[model samples]
Target: MLMSPTVRSGTLVMLIALLRSPATTVAVPPPSSVQASAIGADVTAGKHLFERHCAVCHGIEGKGGRGPGLNRAQLAHAPDDTALKSVISDGISPDMPAGWFLTDEDVANLAAYVRSFSNIPSEPLPGDAVRGAGVYAKGGCSNCHIVAGAGFGYGPELSNIGIRRSAPYIRKAIVKPGATMPEGFLLVEAITPSGDKIEGIRVNEDTFSIQIKDATGQFHSLRKQDLKELQKLRGESPMPSYGGVFNTSELDDLVAYLASLRGKQ
Candidate 1:
Protein backbone atom coordinates (compact mmCIF):
# COMPACT_ATOMS: atom_id res chain seq x y z
CA MET A 1 0.00 0.00 0.00
CA LEU A 2 1.30 3.42 -0.82
CA MET A 3 1.77 5.21 2.50
CA SER A 4 0.88 8.81 3.15
CA PRO A 5 3.77 11.19 2.74
CA THR A 6 2.28 13.53 5.30
CA VAL A 7 3.66 13.04 8.75
CA ARG A 8 3.07 15.58 11.51
CA SER A 9 6.38 17.22 12.20
CA GLY A 10 5.80 16.57 15.87
CA THR A 11 5.45 12.86 15.26
CA LEU A 12 8.69 12.74 13.32
CA VAL A 13 10.91 13.05 16.40
CA MET A 14 9.06 10.35 18.29
CA LEU A 15 9.02 8.03 15.34
CA ILE A 16 12.73 8.45 14.87
CA ALA A 17 13.37 7.54 18.47
CA LEU A 18 11.24 4.42 18.21
CA LEU A 19 12.95 3.38 15.02
CA ARG A 20 16.35 3.34 16.68
CA SER A 21 15.38 1.06 19.50
CA PRO A 22 16.59 -2.55 19.61
CA ALA A 23 13.07 -3.77 20.42
CA THR A 24 11.71 -2.17 17.28
CA THR A 25 12.10 -5.47 15.41
CA VAL A 26 8.36 -5.98 15.05
CA ALA A 27 6.33 -8.48 13.00
CA VAL A 28 9.75 -10.05 12.50
CA PRO A 29 11.79 -11.62 15.24
CA PRO A 30 14.53 -9.84 17.10
CA PRO A 31 17.92 -10.24 15.51
CA SER A 32 18.48 -13.92 16.20
CA SER A 33 21.57 -14.69 18.18
CA VAL A 34 23.82 -17.15 16.41
CA GLN A 35 24.57 -18.66 19.80
CA ALA A 36 20.88 -19.00 20.65
CA SER A 37 20.42 -22.05 18.51
CA ALA A 38 22.48 -24.77 16.90
CA ILE A 39 21.09 -23.15 13.78
CA GLY A 40 23.59 -20.44 14.62
CA ALA A 41 21.81 -17.45 13.11
CA ASP A 42 22.05 -13.81 14.07
CA VAL A 43 21.97 -10.53 12.20
CA THR A 44 25.77 -10.60 12.07
CA ALA A 45 25.87 -14.20 10.91
CA GLY A 46 23.03 -13.41 8.56
CA LYS A 47 25.19 -10.63 7.19
CA HIS A 48 27.79 -13.26 6.39
CA LEU A 49 25.15 -15.43 4.79
CA PHE A 50 24.09 -12.45 2.74
CA GLU A 51 27.63 -11.69 1.59
CA ARG A 52 28.67 -15.24 0.72
CA HIS A 53 25.46 -16.33 -0.95
CA CYS A 54 23.42 -13.22 -1.62
CA ALA A 55 25.67 -10.16 -1.93
CA VAL A 56 26.76 -10.69 -5.53
CA CYS A 57 23.13 -10.36 -6.55
CA HIS A 58 21.26 -8.69 -3.67
CA GLY A 59 24.09 -6.39 -2.51
CA ILE A 60 25.95 -6.45 0.80
CA GLU A 61 23.15 -4.97 2.90
CA GLY A 62 20.36 -5.87 0.50
CA LYS A 63 20.24 -2.45 -1.16
CA GLY A 64 19.62 -4.49 -4.32
CA GLY A 65 21.32 -4.82 -7.69
CA ARG A 66 21.07 -8.02 -9.70
CA GLY A 67 18.73 -8.82 -6.83
CA PRO A 68 16.28 -6.68 -4.79
CA GLY A 69 16.84 -4.80 -1.59
CA LEU A 70 15.56 -6.78 1.40
CA ASN A 71 15.51 -3.86 3.83
CA ARG A 72 12.02 -2.70 2.96
CA ALA A 73 9.36 -1.40 5.39
CA GLN A 74 6.60 -3.26 3.57
CA LEU A 75 8.11 -6.61 4.47
CA ALA A 76 7.78 -5.52 8.06
CA HIS A 77 4.00 -5.13 7.89
CA ALA A 78 3.15 -8.14 5.78
CA PRO A 79 2.24 -11.59 7.04
CA ASP A 80 5.04 -13.27 8.87
CA ASP A 81 7.02 -16.55 8.77
CA THR A 82 5.03 -18.47 6.21
CA ALA A 83 5.05 -15.75 3.59
CA LEU A 84 8.66 -14.85 4.20
CA LYS A 85 9.91 -18.44 4.25
CA SER A 86 7.98 -19.25 1.11
CA VAL A 87 9.56 -16.38 -0.77
CA ILE A 88 12.94 -17.31 0.60
CA SER A 89 12.49 -20.95 -0.35
CA ASP A 90 10.53 -20.51 -3.54
CA GLY A 91 11.77 -17.06 -4.53
CA ILE A 92 9.96 -14.22 -6.31
CA SER A 93 8.80 -15.16 -9.76
CA PRO A 94 11.00 -14.47 -12.82
CA ASP A 95 13.91 -12.35 -11.64
CA MET A 96 14.71 -13.95 -8.29
CA PRO A 97 16.35 -17.34 -8.26
CA ALA A 98 14.85 -19.93 -5.94
CA GLY A 99 16.31 -20.21 -2.50
CA TRP A 100 16.49 -23.98 -2.60
CA PHE A 101 20.22 -23.49 -2.09
CA LEU A 102 19.63 -22.26 1.44
CA THR A 103 19.11 -24.59 4.35
CA ASP A 104 16.07 -23.68 6.43
CA GLU A 105 18.42 -22.43 9.14
CA ASP A 106 20.22 -20.22 6.69
CA VAL A 107 16.94 -18.88 5.43
CA ALA A 108 15.98 -17.94 8.96
CA ASN A 109 19.22 -16.05 9.34
CA LEU A 110 18.59 -14.24 6.14
CA ALA A 111 15.09 -13.37 7.22
CA ALA A 112 16.44 -11.82 10.38
CA TYR A 113 18.79 -9.64 8.45
CA VAL A 114 16.03 -8.56 6.12
CA ARG A 115 13.61 -7.90 8.95
CA SER A 116 16.05 -5.90 10.99
CA PHE A 117 15.07 -2.85 8.99
CA SER A 118 11.41 -2.77 9.95
CA ASN A 119 9.59 -0.90 12.76
CA ILE A 120 7.91 -4.14 13.93
CA PRO A 121 4.63 -2.49 14.98
CA SER A 122 1.12 -2.96 13.71
CA GLU A 123 0.47 0.75 13.96
CA PRO A 124 0.94 2.89 10.92
CA LEU A 125 3.05 5.98 11.14
CA PRO A 126 1.40 9.03 12.64
CA GLY A 127 1.20 10.88 9.37
CA ASP A 128 -0.19 14.36 9.03
CA ALA A 129 -2.12 14.88 5.85
CA VAL A 130 -1.18 18.56 5.78
CA ARG A 131 2.49 17.86 6.17
CA GLY A 132 2.40 15.13 3.54
CA ALA A 133 1.49 17.71 0.93
CA GLY A 134 4.75 19.51 1.56
CA VAL A 135 6.73 16.25 1.57
CA TYR A 136 5.30 15.36 -1.80
CA ALA A 137 6.62 18.61 -3.14
CA LYS A 138 9.98 18.55 -1.36
CA GLY A 139 10.94 14.87 -1.79
CA GLY A 140 11.17 15.23 -5.57
CA CYS A 141 8.95 12.19 -5.96
CA SER A 142 7.32 13.88 -8.92
CA ASN A 143 10.66 13.68 -10.68
CA CYS A 144 10.18 9.95 -11.11
CA HIS A 145 6.81 8.82 -9.74
CA ILE A 146 3.90 10.75 -11.15
CA VAL A 147 0.82 11.11 -9.02
CA ALA A 148 -2.66 12.24 -9.89
CA GLY A 149 -2.42 14.59 -12.86
CA ALA A 150 0.92 16.09 -11.78
CA GLY A 151 4.61 15.20 -11.33
CA PHE A 152 7.44 14.24 -13.68
CA GLY A 153 7.42 12.03 -16.73
CA TYR A 154 10.10 9.50 -15.88
CA GLY A 155 8.41 6.65 -13.94
CA PRO A 156 5.08 4.93 -13.72
CA GLU A 157 2.43 7.41 -12.67
CA LEU A 158 1.10 7.08 -9.15
CA SER A 159 -2.32 8.39 -10.10
CA ASN A 160 -4.05 5.66 -8.11
CA ILE A 161 -1.06 4.09 -6.45
CA GLY A 162 -2.86 3.79 -3.13
CA ILE A 163 -5.57 1.72 -4.76
CA ARG A 164 -3.37 -0.56 -6.78
CA ARG A 165 -0.51 -1.12 -4.30
CA SER A 166 -0.30 -2.05 -0.66
CA ALA A 167 1.94 -0.37 1.91
CA PRO A 168 4.37 -3.25 2.20
CA TYR A 169 4.50 -3.77 -1.54
CA ILE A 170 5.24 -0.10 -2.11
CA ARG A 171 8.04 -0.23 0.43
CA LYS A 172 9.50 -3.34 -1.17
CA ALA A 173 9.47 -1.74 -4.59
CA ILE A 174 11.40 1.22 -3.24
CA VAL A 175 14.13 -0.73 -1.46
CA LYS A 176 14.38 -3.84 -3.63
CA PRO A 177 13.81 -3.35 -7.30
CA GLY A 178 15.18 -6.25 -9.31
CA ALA A 179 12.61 -8.74 -8.05
CA THR A 180 9.73 -7.23 -9.95
CA MET A 181 11.18 -4.37 -11.94
CA PRO A 182 8.86 -3.10 -14.60
CA GLU A 183 10.34 -3.69 -18.02
CA GLY A 184 11.03 -0.88 -20.54
CA PHE A 185 12.52 1.25 -17.77
CA LEU A 186 15.99 -0.19 -18.18
CA LEU A 187 18.87 2.32 -18.12
CA VAL A 188 21.17 2.28 -21.16
CA GLU A 189 24.63 3.71 -21.78
CA ALA A 190 26.63 4.79 -24.79
CA ILE A 191 30.18 6.14 -25.25
CA THR A 192 31.04 8.42 -28.16
CA PRO A 193 34.32 8.83 -30.09
CA SER A 194 34.66 12.39 -28.76
CA GLY A 195 34.77 10.65 -25.38
CA ASP A 196 31.29 11.88 -24.54
CA LYS A 197 29.22 9.40 -22.55
CA ILE A 198 25.49 9.25 -22.02
CA GLU A 199 22.97 7.21 -20.09
CA GLY A 200 19.23 7.34 -19.61
CA ILE A 201 16.04 5.36 -19.82
CA ARG A 202 16.18 3.33 -23.03
CA VAL A 203 13.38 4.48 -25.27
CA ASN A 204 14.13 2.92 -28.68
CA GLU A 205 17.18 1.55 -30.37
CA ASP A 206 18.39 -0.06 -33.57
CA THR A 207 21.81 -0.79 -35.13
CA PHE A 208 22.32 2.88 -35.90
CA SER A 209 21.23 4.85 -32.82
CA ILE A 210 19.38 4.55 -29.54
CA GLN A 211 17.05 6.93 -27.76
CA ILE A 212 17.00 7.70 -24.08
CA LYS A 213 15.07 10.08 -21.85
CA ASP A 214 16.81 11.56 -18.84
CA ALA A 215 15.07 12.66 -15.62
CA THR A 216 14.54 16.13 -16.99
CA GLY A 217 12.72 14.76 -20.07
CA GLN A 218 15.60 15.64 -22.34
CA PHE A 219 16.14 12.96 -24.96
CA HIS A 220 19.61 12.07 -26.10
CA SER A 221 19.95 10.57 -29.55
CA LEU A 222 23.10 8.46 -29.31
CA ARG A 223 24.61 7.36 -32.60
CA LYS A 224 25.84 3.80 -32.54
CA GLN A 225 28.03 4.56 -35.56
CA ASP A 226 30.23 7.13 -33.86
CA LEU A 227 30.07 5.41 -30.49
CA LYS A 228 33.32 3.85 -29.38
CA GLU A 229 31.41 1.55 -27.06
CA LEU A 230 27.86 0.74 -26.10
CA GLN A 231 26.83 -1.17 -23.04
CA LYS A 232 23.55 -2.41 -21.70
CA LEU A 233 23.23 -3.82 -18.24
CA ARG A 234 20.42 -5.38 -16.26
CA GLY A 235 21.02 -4.69 -12.62
CA GLU A 236 20.02 -2.46 -9.70
CA SER A 237 18.77 1.00 -10.51
CA PRO A 238 20.65 4.23 -10.03
CA MET A 239 17.77 5.17 -7.77
CA PRO A 240 18.98 4.26 -4.33
CA SER A 241 16.34 1.82 -3.24
CA TYR A 242 16.56 3.14 0.27
CA GLY A 243 17.57 0.21 2.43
CA GLY A 244 20.14 1.91 4.62
CA VAL A 245 19.14 5.17 3.01
CA PHE A 246 15.93 5.89 4.94
CA ASN A 247 15.33 5.08 8.53
CA THR A 248 12.47 2.67 9.10
CA SER A 249 10.18 5.42 10.39
CA GLU A 250 11.01 7.78 7.56
CA LEU A 251 10.08 5.00 5.24
CA ASP A 252 6.91 4.41 7.18
CA ASP A 253 6.11 8.10 6.95
CA LEU A 254 6.90 8.11 3.27
CA VAL A 255 4.74 5.09 2.68
CA ALA A 256 1.92 6.50 4.74
CA TYR A 257 2.49 9.75 2.99
CA LEU A 258 2.17 8.21 -0.45
CA ALA A 259 -0.80 6.14 0.51
CA SER A 260 -2.59 9.32 1.38
CA LEU A 261 -1.99 10.68 -2.10
CA ARG A 262 -4.62 8.46 -3.60
CA GLY A 263 -7.86 9.96 -4.96
CA LYS A 264 -8.18 13.65 -5.82
CA GLN A 265 -5.33 16.10 -5.30
Candidate 2:
Protein backbone atom coordinates (compact mmCIF):
# COMPACT_ATOMS: atom_id res chain seq x y z
CA MET A 1 0.00 0.00 0.00
CA LEU A 2 2.73 2.56 -0.97
CA MET A 3 1.45 6.18 -1.39
CA SER A 4 1.95 8.20 -4.60
CA PRO A 5 5.21 10.29 -4.73
CA THR A 6 3.32 13.59 -4.26
CA VAL A 7 1.24 12.20 -1.32
CA ARG A 8 4.39 10.70 0.27
CA SER A 9 6.25 14.07 0.12
CA GLY A 10 3.18 15.92 1.58
CA THR A 11 2.88 13.44 4.44
CA LEU A 12 6.62 13.80 5.24
CA VAL A 13 6.34 17.62 5.23
CA MET A 14 3.25 17.50 7.54
CA LEU A 15 5.10 15.16 9.94
CA ILE A 16 8.10 17.55 10.11
CA ALA A 17 5.84 20.56 10.65
CA LEU A 18 4.01 18.76 13.46
CA LEU A 19 7.32 17.91 15.12
CA ARG A 20 8.46 21.59 15.00
CA SER A 21 5.17 23.08 16.21
CA PRO A 22 4.81 24.54 19.74
CA ALA A 23 1.42 22.77 20.14
CA THR A 24 3.32 19.45 20.31
CA THR A 25 5.25 20.62 23.44
CA VAL A 26 4.06 19.53 26.88
CA ALA A 27 2.63 22.20 29.19
CA VAL A 28 4.54 22.77 32.43
CA PRO A 29 2.41 22.63 35.58
CA PRO A 30 2.51 25.17 38.40
CA PRO A 31 5.44 25.12 40.84
CA SER A 32 5.73 21.96 42.91
CA SER A 33 5.24 22.06 46.73
CA VAL A 34 9.01 22.15 47.31
CA GLN A 35 9.45 25.05 44.86
CA ALA A 36 6.49 26.87 46.44
CA SER A 37 8.03 26.38 49.88
CA ALA A 38 11.30 27.84 48.67
CA ILE A 39 9.52 30.95 47.32
CA GLY A 40 7.65 31.36 50.62
CA ALA A 41 10.94 31.17 52.49
CA ASP A 42 12.40 33.81 50.19
CA VAL A 43 9.50 36.19 50.83
CA THR A 44 9.75 35.63 54.60
CA ALA A 45 13.48 36.28 54.53
CA GLY A 46 12.85 39.42 52.47
CA LYS A 47 10.36 40.67 55.04
CA HIS A 48 12.92 40.34 57.81
CA LEU A 49 15.54 42.08 55.69
CA PHE A 50 13.16 44.99 54.97
CA GLU A 51 12.32 45.39 58.66
CA ARG A 52 15.97 45.61 59.59
CA HIS A 53 17.32 47.76 56.77
CA CYS A 54 14.39 49.61 55.18
CA ALA A 55 11.74 50.03 57.87
CA VAL A 56 13.32 53.16 59.31
CA CYS A 57 12.82 55.23 56.19
CA HIS A 58 10.06 53.33 54.36
CA GLY A 59 7.97 52.83 57.54
CA ILE A 60 7.47 49.65 59.51
CA GLU A 61 4.47 48.76 57.37
CA GLY A 62 5.97 50.24 54.16
CA LYS A 63 3.32 53.01 54.29
CA GLY A 64 6.13 55.57 53.98
CA GLY A 65 7.77 58.13 56.26
CA ARG A 66 10.95 59.77 55.01
CA GLY A 67 10.72 57.68 51.83
CA PRO A 68 7.93 57.03 49.30
CA GLY A 69 5.25 54.46 50.08
CA LEU A 70 5.71 50.88 48.93
CA ASN A 71 2.09 49.84 49.55
CA ARG A 72 0.89 51.37 46.26
CA ALA A 73 -0.02 49.10 43.33
CA GLN A 74 2.66 50.83 41.26
CA LEU A 75 5.83 52.82 41.83
CA ALA A 76 6.98 55.56 39.47
CA HIS A 77 10.64 54.54 39.54
CA ALA A 78 10.07 50.80 39.89
CA PRO A 79 7.30 49.81 37.49
CA ASP A 80 8.38 46.16 37.37
CA ASP A 81 10.16 43.52 39.44
CA THR A 82 13.50 43.97 37.64
CA ALA A 83 13.49 47.74 38.19
CA LEU A 84 12.52 47.24 41.85
CA LYS A 85 15.46 44.90 42.35
CA SER A 86 17.84 47.36 40.66
CA VAL A 87 16.58 50.26 42.78
CA ILE A 88 17.09 48.20 45.91
CA SER A 89 20.64 47.38 44.86
CA ASP A 90 21.74 50.65 43.27
CA GLY A 91 19.52 53.17 45.11
CA ILE A 92 18.36 56.49 43.57
CA SER A 93 21.43 58.74 43.81
CA PRO A 94 21.58 61.50 46.46
CA ASP A 95 17.97 60.86 47.51
CA MET A 96 18.37 57.13 48.18
CA PRO A 97 21.64 55.48 49.19
CA ALA A 98 22.54 52.21 47.44
CA GLY A 99 22.24 48.89 49.27
CA TRP A 100 25.99 48.28 49.04
CA PHE A 101 25.98 45.53 51.65
CA LEU A 102 23.18 43.46 50.09
CA THR A 103 23.97 40.37 48.04
CA ASP A 104 22.06 39.36 44.90
CA GLU A 105 19.92 36.91 46.84
CA ASP A 106 19.31 39.48 49.60
CA VAL A 107 18.20 42.04 47.02
CA ALA A 108 15.84 39.52 45.46
CA ASN A 109 14.28 38.74 48.82
CA LEU A 110 13.94 42.43 49.66
CA ALA A 111 12.25 43.12 46.35
CA ALA A 112 9.81 40.29 46.98
CA TYR A 113 8.94 41.71 50.39
CA VAL A 114 8.49 45.21 48.97
CA ARG A 115 6.31 43.78 46.21
CA SER A 116 4.08 42.20 48.82
CA PHE A 117 3.20 45.69 50.00
CA SER A 118 1.27 46.29 46.77
CA ASN A 119 -1.41 43.94 48.07
CA ILE A 120 -2.12 46.31 50.93
CA PRO A 121 -4.73 48.93 50.00
CA SER A 122 -3.76 52.59 49.81
CA GLU A 123 -5.06 54.62 52.76
CA PRO A 124 -8.01 56.89 52.05
CA LEU A 125 -7.68 60.66 52.28
CA PRO A 126 -9.63 62.14 55.23
CA GLY A 127 -10.25 65.65 53.89
CA ASP A 128 -11.68 67.28 50.78
CA ALA A 129 -9.24 67.98 47.94
CA VAL A 130 -11.19 71.06 46.85
CA ARG A 131 -11.09 72.61 50.31
CA GLY A 132 -7.46 71.61 50.54
CA ALA A 133 -6.67 73.77 47.51
CA GLY A 134 -8.14 76.75 49.30
CA VAL A 135 -6.09 75.90 52.38
CA TYR A 136 -2.94 75.73 50.23
CA ALA A 137 -3.59 79.19 48.83
CA LYS A 138 -4.41 80.61 52.25
CA GLY A 139 -1.24 79.17 53.74
CA GLY A 140 0.84 80.63 50.93
CA CYS A 141 2.27 77.14 50.21
CA SER A 142 3.14 78.15 46.64
CA ASN A 143 5.76 80.55 47.98
CA CYS A 144 7.91 77.57 48.94
CA HIS A 145 6.52 74.66 46.92
CA ILE A 146 5.96 74.33 43.18
CA VAL A 147 3.13 72.40 41.52
CA ALA A 148 2.61 71.99 37.77
CA GLY A 149 4.96 74.78 36.66
CA ALA A 150 3.38 77.21 39.14
CA GLY A 151 4.80 78.51 42.44
CA PHE A 152 8.36 78.88 43.69
CA GLY A 153 11.08 76.26 43.18
CA TYR A 154 12.49 76.74 46.66
CA GLY A 155 11.33 73.50 48.21
CA PRO A 156 10.89 70.03 46.73
CA GLU A 157 8.58 70.14 43.71
CA LEU A 158 5.07 68.87 44.41
CA SER A 159 4.02 68.29 40.80
CA ASN A 160 4.18 64.52 41.19
CA ILE A 161 4.39 64.44 44.96
CA GLY A 162 1.03 62.68 45.23
CA ILE A 163 2.44 59.69 43.40
CA ARG A 164 5.85 59.96 45.07
CA ARG A 165 4.90 60.46 48.73
CA SER A 166 2.21 59.02 50.97
CA ALA A 167 -0.42 61.26 52.53
CA PRO A 168 0.82 60.65 56.07
CA TYR A 169 4.33 61.64 55.05
CA ILE A 170 3.03 64.87 53.49
CA ARG A 171 1.05 65.70 56.61
CA LYS A 172 4.04 65.04 58.82
CA ALA A 173 6.19 67.27 56.61
CA ILE A 174 3.73 70.15 56.88
CA VAL A 175 3.43 69.82 60.66
CA LYS A 176 7.14 69.30 61.23
CA PRO A 177 9.25 70.53 58.36
CA GLY A 178 12.55 69.91 60.16
CA ALA A 179 11.86 66.21 60.77
CA THR A 180 12.97 65.29 57.26
CA MET A 181 14.62 68.20 55.49
CA PRO A 182 14.87 66.30 52.17
CA GLU A 183 18.22 65.49 50.51
CA GLY A 184 19.25 68.66 48.65
CA PHE A 185 17.61 71.43 50.72
CA LEU A 186 20.37 71.89 53.29
CA LEU A 187 20.18 75.14 55.26
CA VAL A 188 23.31 77.25 55.29
CA GLU A 189 24.29 80.60 56.86
CA ALA A 190 27.30 82.41 55.44
CA ILE A 191 29.02 85.57 56.68
CA THR A 192 30.82 87.69 54.09
CA PRO A 193 34.20 89.36 54.64
CA SER A 194 32.35 92.68 55.09
CA GLY A 195 30.29 91.39 58.09
CA ASP A 196 27.11 90.68 56.05
CA LYS A 197 25.26 87.52 57.00
CA ILE A 198 23.30 85.62 54.37
CA GLU A 199 21.09 82.64 55.11
CA GLY A 200 19.56 80.34 52.51
CA ILE A 201 19.22 76.79 51.23
CA ARG A 202 22.46 75.39 49.83
CA VAL A 203 21.94 75.00 46.08
CA ASN A 204 25.41 73.61 45.38
CA GLU A 205 28.78 73.53 47.05
CA ASP A 206 32.38 72.47 46.45
CA THR A 207 35.69 72.84 48.24
CA PHE A 208 36.27 76.32 46.80
CA SER A 209 32.77 77.77 46.26
CA ILE A 210 29.17 77.43 47.52
CA GLN A 211 25.92 78.49 45.89
CA ILE A 212 22.95 79.55 48.00
CA LYS A 213 19.38 80.61 47.22
CA ASP A 214 18.25 83.00 49.93
CA ALA A 215 14.66 83.36 51.19
CA THR A 216 14.23 86.40 49.00
CA GLY A 217 14.78 84.10 45.96
CA GLN A 218 18.26 85.53 45.33
CA PHE A 219 21.17 83.38 44.18
CA HIS A 220 24.54 84.03 45.81
CA SER A 221 27.70 82.28 44.69
CA LEU A 222 30.38 82.95 47.26
CA ARG A 223 34.01 81.89 47.48
CA LYS A 224 34.69 79.84 50.61
CA GLN A 225 38.00 81.59 51.12
CA ASP A 226 36.39 85.04 51.23
CA LEU A 227 33.68 84.11 53.75
CA LYS A 228 34.30 84.97 57.37
CA GLU A 229 32.06 82.16 58.54
CA LEU A 230 30.21 79.34 56.76
CA GLN A 231 27.77 77.42 58.86
CA LYS A 232 26.21 74.24 57.54
CA LEU A 233 22.98 73.60 59.40
CA ARG A 234 22.62 69.89 59.02
CA GLY A 235 19.18 68.35 59.75
CA GLU A 236 17.72 71.86 59.70
CA SER A 237 14.96 73.05 57.38
CA PRO A 238 14.27 76.65 56.32
CA MET A 239 10.58 75.84 55.74
CA PRO A 240 8.57 76.80 58.79
CA SER A 241 6.42 74.31 60.63
CA TYR A 242 2.73 74.93 59.94
CA GLY A 243 1.48 73.01 62.98
CA GLY A 244 0.29 76.14 64.72
CA VAL A 245 -1.01 77.92 61.64
CA PHE A 246 -3.30 75.24 60.20
CA ASN A 247 -6.05 73.85 62.37
CA THR A 248 -6.84 70.15 62.27
CA SER A 249 -9.34 70.46 59.40
CA GLU A 250 -7.21 72.88 57.41
CA LEU A 251 -4.19 70.64 57.81
CA ASP A 252 -6.17 67.62 56.61
CA ASP A 253 -7.49 69.61 53.64
CA LEU A 254 -3.98 70.75 52.70
CA VAL A 255 -2.68 67.20 52.87
CA ALA A 256 -5.58 66.03 50.73
CA TYR A 257 -4.92 68.75 48.13
CA LEU A 258 -1.20 67.96 47.96
CA ALA A 259 -1.94 64.23 47.69
CA SER A 260 -4.34 64.92 44.80
CA LEU A 261 -1.53 66.46 42.73
CA ARG A 262 -0.52 63.46 40.59
CA GLY A 263 0.78 65.67 37.73
CA LYS A 264 -0.29 65.32 34.07
CA GLN A 265 -2.71 62.61 35.05
Worst 10 residues of 1 by lDDT: 31-40
Over 1-265, each residue of candidate 1 has an lDDT whose tens digit, in order, gives: 0111265644544654564466763633353332122122345556677788777665565655544345555542224655666777886644456789898878877766666544333344465545655656766677777776787867667675553445556667767765545545577777879887777678888888899777677898877888888888677465656666666656667767765555552
The lDDT values for all models are 0.61, 0.79
For model 2, how does the per-residue alpha-carbon lDDT over 1-265 read when each residue is reduced to its tens digit? Answer: 1112244655645643563367753432354322222232256567789999999888988988778788977677777666887899999867678999999889877876787777678788789999999999899989988888889988888998886667888998998888866667689999999999999999899999999999888999999999999999988888899999989999999999988888875
Candidate 2 stretches greater than 4 Å from native? 1-41
After superposition, the stretches of candidate 1 with alpha carbons farther than 4 Å from their true spots are 1-134, 177-180, 260-265
Model 2: how far residue 185 lies from native, Å: 3.3
TM-score of 2: 0.80
C-alpha RMSD (angstroms) for model 1:
14.6
